[model samples]
Target: MHGYANPARFLRLAKLLTAPLLIGGGLLAVAVLAWALAAAPAERLQGDSVKILFVHVPTAWLAMGGWSAIAIASLSELVWRHPLAGVAARAVALPGAVFAALCLATGSLWGRPAWGTWWVWDGRLTSMLVLLFLYLAYIALADAATRDGQGQSRIPAIFGLVGAVNIPIIHYSVLWWNSLHQPPSITAGKSEMAAPFLIGLMASTLAFSLLFGGVVLARMRAILADTQAEARLRRRAMNAADV
Candidate 1:
């Protein structure tokens, strides 16, 4: 991990991985989506409404996963002083927020048919909404810090770490509270879900995870480039002032 602390080396690896991840993820997503739409059998209970699981489940996982990444990176920045950690945290914000939004939208769509409503204030749903707000707040804070030349500030990192508390809450909400949201169909090496739906969900999850990783790397590279360009501009301004 520390070996790639050097930006040049990290950038090289990111360039190599970014394209493959995006391409592979895109192909896998199409395949999985098609399988979900056509091949996966309709659930006896939810019928066609179950189809959205392929999309919604993955988005929900990534939404939490993205924040988890931010939390880990934040820890690295604070404890290990990793140079790229802040970049990682900031880069993931937008994608994480996007997934959170998608999760909510799809959840609503799924619920409309299954739960007979477009929205619910259940524990799981509310916590997930809180996660979305956290992502937005982090993005706004990180962007403001960058614009104000406080990009290296510790505030955002602290927030990232603090916001992680909600992750467990989101996960255990359905279990802890009486909610319309179903209990986890998959658990410690066991699954109550039918085989076909499980298979499709897993495939869709992998594809979305790959897509998330690729986006994060691309965003990291962009953040680095912007920082480098700003540094160059600063040097020129200093030189001009001296003359």
Candidate 2:
């Protein structure tokens, strides 16, 4: 892991794996989407509206997964001083934010038919909304810190740690309060979701996970290139100053 932290090694590995990662990620996404949207049967109750679960549930899961990644990266940056940690954290922000937005939108769409409302101030929904805000705040803070010659600042890292505290709150929102959203349909303790629905849901989750990794890898490559360019400019400036 530490050896790969060297940018050159990391870039070399990325280049080697890029083709397979993209191909596998693309194929998995397409297969899952097709199966989820077409092959999966409609819910007995929610009918076609239940199909929204394919998108909504997966996005919600990724929203949490992305935050967890950011938190781990932030921790590594603070403790292990991993050079790529900040890059990984920053790379995940926009995609996580986008997924969070999709979760909220799809949830609202699912809610309208199932709950007779387009929006609600229920605990689960509200907490998830806060999660979305946290992602946006993390991105904004990171962006500001990186700009204006404050690139080495710890503020964004601190913000990421603090924002991670909200992840549990979001996860337990349904359990902690009498909310509009139901408990996990498939759980070790109980299972409310039918077998076919569970299959589709799991497939969707796998697809989204692959897609998220692909996006993060692509973003990390871009960040690495930018970092290298900046380093080159700094070296040139130092050499000119010496002359």
Best by lDDT: 1
Q: Which lDDT tens digits does candidate 2 get at residues 36-105?
A: 6778887778888888988899999899889989999998898898999999899999899999999999
Each model's TM-score? 0.98, 0.93
lDDT of each: 0.95, 0.86
What total of clashing residue pairs does each candidate reach? 0, 0
Model 2's TM-score against the true structure: 0.93
Model 1 CA lDDT for position 67: 98
User: RMSD to native for every prediction?
Assistant: 1.0, 1.8
Q: Write the per-residue lDDT of candidate 1 for residues 127-215, one digit (tens) a residue.
A: 99999999999999898878877654688999999999999999999999999999999999899988888888999999999999999
Segments in model 2 whose C-alpha atoms lie over 4 Å from true places: 150-152
